[model samples]
Target: FHIELPMSLSDLVRLCGFRAAASPIHCRASSPPHSLPPAPVDGLDESLLADDLGAMELELRHRDAYLRSLGSPSAETVARSTLVTDSQVDQIMASEGPLDRLKDLYALNEDNEPSYELASVMLVSMATFTYLNVRYTVQERRLAGVSFEERNKLTVFASKQQASRRKMDYITMRALRLGLKRSASSLIFAPLFLGGAQCISAVRGRSSPLDFLPSGIAAGACVRGAHGLQPMLGGAFLGGFLGAVVGTVVYGIQMYCGLTYEEMRRYRLTERSERDARLMAKLSAAREQA
Candidate 1:
């Protein structure tokens, strides 16, 4: 639960209860509860029940899946329920006038050892940042979905976010374009570049501001190692530098905007609170099923 205190933004506001994910995604729709219908035949009623018994077996097979969707998980069930959001750059490649919600889904063979969890997260981050870019451009172009406030306090907040995203997106698209212009070796390096990008995004999406030097160094080292370069120091250094540059840009945005990723996340609490309220209302509408 988030608390509240006096503040200029909202005099009674305090932040808590929000958790940032390392990054990942997926889920499914809910189903109605099933029940056994009464048998309507005479002597055949016993036969019908025998058939019902068979139906029961089928239901039992999926019992765990049904229960798990309602919230709890059975021992055999995978603990997977999460949503990964898009960033400003992701928004540009993807949405609204002159903008689109660009997305690319990667197929994990499940045969290789690279963690699928991390892949899923990276995909979500890419998607999110693209969206942010689109949103920003739309606003700048005075395109649709740009809500102008009377006092426009929220306008400034939205503007800053959009501006920050635009700057970030500019750098990424520049890198991508550069890659396309280069030879096959550079093309092959794109994936390694992506991992470096992810390292920045994973930290950027969180509540706290991140230092880029660490991510740059780590991604650079990993890339160098994966490429089997002896000494490896050069690649690592370059990777670290790039990673830090990305991280530093985002850090500056956080400072200038006076809102950490966490504060921006709070803008979401109102939506969450409403969702919880709606959920409780539905829960009170029904009883437990067999």
Candidate 2:
């Protein structure tokens, strides 16, 4: 007798408890042929995923190292790369003395004009000269009529008498006041004289002795203008005569020495450098001893 099964083959396997007996070919055949297979899940191989993660971490570390190498150097690296060492810097600083500092204060560079240096030099010299002149003139006038013996007698009397002390004090104060006034005037006069002389020299395209005459005359006129016409004339005459004498002397010196202003300045700078070098050597020896 022949019989037909009502259930499917999968149901027959389940009923008969024959799961192991179910064939893969039969299972595949049971499904629709048009359907695709399911995709693989990611966590199937943990070691492979871990290996990939470790490779990415190593690459990131390499990239970070490269970026750091391209960045600015560390402080220690900069210090090592510097041209001047700390001890050399300290020595350089220590080499500059008071005189060097003073020279630096009035230092002239190529960009600076000669007129400025001339004016500064003249101002200092004239101030000293004016003070001495005023003091001498005052003392000379005070002692004009008296003989040498009489002056000695007067000095002795002044030392003994209180009234003479007041007179002596008056003379001293008067001389001081006159010296200060003339020195103050010289501060203004010297700059004007030098500036005017410089301007005249520049316009003429060369220096001349005659350049000082006009400058001195103008400076004297300005200074004495507040006094009177007679005083102004007298000052101008005196200034012109002195200016001419000074010019002649200066020209003579230049001719004798064969040195220009620039040459003199260079010589002075060389001398100063030598002096500074000697000073530096002494300081270095002293430091070594210490």
Q: Best-fitting candidate, measured by TM-score?
A: 2
lDDT of 1 by residue, 162-281 (tens): 855755565555444443333223323334455444434434444333445655565556546655676367777886677567667766776688554344433443334445555654
**lDDT string, candidate 2, 11-111, tens digits:** 87555433222443543555443432423344658888899999998886776566457563333343344334445544544565545434443455555
Which segments of candidate 1 are over 4 A away from where they belong? Answer: 1-210, 226-231, 255-259, 268-270, 282-290
Superposition error at 279 for model 2 (Å): 27
lDDT of 1 at 231: 38
Clash list (residue pairs), candidate 2: none
Task: Give per-model TM-scores.
Answer: 0.30, 0.39
> Which consecutive 10 residues in model 1 have the weakest lDDT in total?
18-27
